[model samples]
Target: MSDLYGRHKAVLPDWLALYYADPIEITHGEGRHVWDADGKRYLDFFGGILTTMTAHALPEITKAVSEQAGRIIHSSTLYLNRPMVEMAERIAELSGIPDARVFFTTSGTEANDTALLLATSYRRSNQILAMRNSYHGRSFSTVGITGNKGWSPTSLSPLQTLYVHGGVRTRGPYAELSDDEFIAACVDDLEDLLGHVRPPAALIAEPIQGVGGFTSPPDGLYAAFRRVLQERGILWIADEVQTGWGRTGEHFWGWQAHAENGPPDILTFAKGIGNGMSIGGVVARAEIMNCLDSNSISTFGGTQITMAAGLANLTYLLEHDLQGNARRVGGLLIERLRAVAAQLPGVREVRGRGLMIGIELVKPGTDTADPETAAAVLEAAREEGLLLGKGGGHNTSALRIAPPLSLTVAEAEEGAAILERALRSRVQ
Candidate 1:
């Protein structure tokens, strides 16, 4: 039989590329580092697109997955699974959504799709109000709501579903608008859309826009939007795929970062929930979830193994109190990044909360355009053995620094040091 590396090189398809994969094959990972096939170790600040909450190869999750694999791995949703039930209850309890009903899926996109379906079903409306530059998922219906034109280029066509945009300014959509003006403008836009479009089923937002350069909406944004939606009898769906599972710090839900607003009607979580175990779920009030009468179901939504992994990941998170660590470490990292921004010439802004941070880079003269400087910094960091992700539509110029919750102060400092060096070297 061919060796692992040889088999991968020989058999892997080319069209499967989503993000650019490193030419070097990664063999293993632990904590905040991953090793390539040739045994070169690299610091992982991107956290596998914010999925590795507990870092790679966490022992508890591995053991749970192994134990379940040894016992029963593929129980259909038609049959009751102990781990599945336990995980659902635990997630609902931790989320603080009373009597929350959950439907599990293997990916964030699937969870968002389920949430959209549920919202449409509950409100009996086809229209959806989504924030500009927001990213929900890649599935057909989910992509319909995603505001990033780069991700959903075809969405603008007449064949696509109708979606109204709220606040989309990048460098500052409403920078000129006063706090109250901004709020009024957003509400006015939504009201006009609702008037013309009639009734939108839901208003989907990413409390802090992840792919849109980690742009945090103005304070009280969600509360204000929720009020409007409530008046219109629309459900509120917070797409916490990138911001949930304690990555945002201080709170388990990203919407909490907005303000002390009431809970959303539906919350979709995926990235950090399983700590890289490929599990996603939608938690909604039992009444909202009960809208579907056996007509909506996914064949592999809640598999036995995925639930076991999720349960184990949650157990590890709770036992170790990693949420507190994310808060402390993430604060340190953000402060340090802000300090770096003060010295860096090309940095436009440093924004975001907890581990999900973004550093926007622009040309020295241009106020809004993203230049090659950001890409250069990323490449330099990679050469220094630090991995990062890119965001900001059409620009790909924001440095995405979403490390795992298991990231330590030392790891964060080390990564920040590399970033600082890279930025200084390029911009200076």
Candidate 2:
């Protein structure tokens, strides 16, 4: 394995990061547990960066993919693709956008990029609005809208992006305000920013900032902001790459938590829907989606096999009521983790919804982020046969926990116990 790791480093890009000091090669997974190449079993907490939404190796999705592959694998969008239409129809019905149109992509980056393109084309402006400490994707255009300094590698972009406040409720200047007050302040800021610039095409945001350590503003913040944007005819784009597909437990989509102004003009989703297959997409009103004058297609998007797998995965989760399972199981898990966090001084905050949770660590008796301690806890968790993930705008100082939506109560308790032990190792 070490030899393979050495070879991986030699061949892979230097920027592609791996978890743990000595990364474990995951050989296989079932339910909420995965086994490494060394045959050590571990509870999976991060869900492959919140992508393996359903349990790993779900038989229904596997069977669907197999059957589809046996019949046909790939057909360019120039030809009719039944599975793609079926998947899109289901998504459009569930999207809540009136007269919705769905466009498939190969990854979240492409989905978001498509959203940007449609917004810019429809509104005829190159300006955009984003949230502070938010991450959209790694593509050049998506990265331009990313406000996280750690993730945005370049300042150059085709679009003029203006970042807004109120994404994080705990650390910013308006952190001390009440919920209503926070929303007001953010809206005022947005209005003020607009006064100084050209009319922007749209405002893009995540209901819960994923790479920003699962932090989010008070509910209705976006609703409040949307009111201001709508007056100016700016579209709202909800980036649900990590927060979609009932991963948050409380709602089918994270945007529902702030549906006061109704659904966003455009919604981008990826991760989890295909349950490990490559599937990403954008949903919007027909007007916005059809704004483009020229035709465009994603070569690898909506392949027959992937669409079949996605359709089966979506059906299985809905039929099995996995969202309800996420709600019940995630509620208990968060309460358990909160109880544990209360005793640990290094733990600053434990925040999230459903299976998507984040534990922000800070130096004891200080407000500064403690990335070293967070990294140490991650290593300790791995040693104890538990896999975890790290994220945060503050040098990756938060521990992200997003297990499969089907995680059992027993698995949650076990993972919590191991994590408690790992966290306590800091002071012991």
Candidate 3:
């Protein structure tokens, strides 16, 4: 381990995971590339788990943050922050929730936590329905609802959580089923589950299970589930931490893929809106948002600096049509990756929408997940100056590829070549 790595281990919790056998210190980043402390530049595919929505060190965002900082950096929610109000207005309109209200938090975890609080308070139920192989957050309430065992550390939770199926469409019992049949089975399962438990406050899910190796059900599965939820008055909370802000290319929001029955009752978003500034929020109809009787405010949630950064970042994203860029580039990248995966025996599947793709590695000629091979490939990719992320259900068996919305065709081609070399280097 490097001296810095040793110092990090000494100070930080062991549970806080670090990537690579030899961890790297990214000293700086620009565009799609980051340079390590030793000055080795790697094309950053993960983008800090998709937190850097636009390009790194974006001048617009930096200027906004700096100007805001110069004016006023931290003002608690008690004050009328213009930047926060303006950003919230834009987000409310873009949220797709009619009569929507937005409440900011510091991170996706806190945003989801607030969503859970609101749902339970509004519905007067602590029961929550979460998808199997799902990841919500690291908080007590979120961990309780998280279906992925690898991340969920404790069973003791404030809410009654039930795990449902259909997140992974490739290896589950329903994997063999057709898309229609899979949706039917999952909906049926959800109905059966509701029958057995008290009415759940909400069914919270990521349209694309980000930490679950970017796994997703058929496009309309959540739409089917939404139909069931509507009848039962169960709120649907789309956890769009990783899938929000047009990262998926085809849709502005991940829930749009399942928008037949209208948008989710509550939507939680973080990671990208601030473009590296800490910005997260929950949006819902005014009715649900106002359900909380007592007053509450996230102290540092919508500070002027972060909100300013968010406003600038969001403006740039919309004006530059990064979503459209994602569609064009992400489409080509996925096709390129699939072509590469086809030649590798260990590659089980190459799937996901737009830039949010995943490559699942498995033992050659067997169904067994090969997390070691996945780890090896990650290291190899790093050696080839390409940085990627690893995630999956329980075992880290899939490589996650989610670059910024500004990823170019040339950069995508370069990343794909490096990834192909990394995959090919693995001994099946």
In order, how many clashes per candidate? 1, 0, 0
Candidate 1 lDDT, tens digit per residue, 309-351? Answer: 8888888887888888988999999999999898866787788
Q: Listing every candidate in turn, what is its Cα RMSD in Å to the true structure after a full C-alpha superposition?
A: 3.0, 0.9, 0.9
Selected candidate, larger TM-score, 1 vs 3: 3
Q: Model 2: clashing residue pairs? A: none
Residue-level lDDT of model 3, residues 1-428, one tens digit each, is 38889899899999999998889899999999999998899999999999988999999888888888889999899999999999999999999999999999999999999999999999999999999999989999999999999998899999998888889998788889999999999889989988888888999999999999999999999999989999989999999999999999999999999999999999999999988889999999999999999978789999999999999999999999999999999999999999988888889999999899999999999878999999999999999999999999938999999999999999999999999888988836
Candidate 2, residue 119: Cα displacement in angstroms equals 0.5
Off by over 4 Å in 1: 1-22, 156-172, 178-180, 259-261
Query: Which scores higher on lDDT, 1 or 2?
Result: 2
Task: Let me know the TM-score candidate 3 reaches against the reference structure.
Answer: 0.99
- Per-residue lDDT, model 1, residue 389, is 84
| TM-score-better candidate, 1 vs 2 | 2
Global lDDT for candidate 1? 0.79
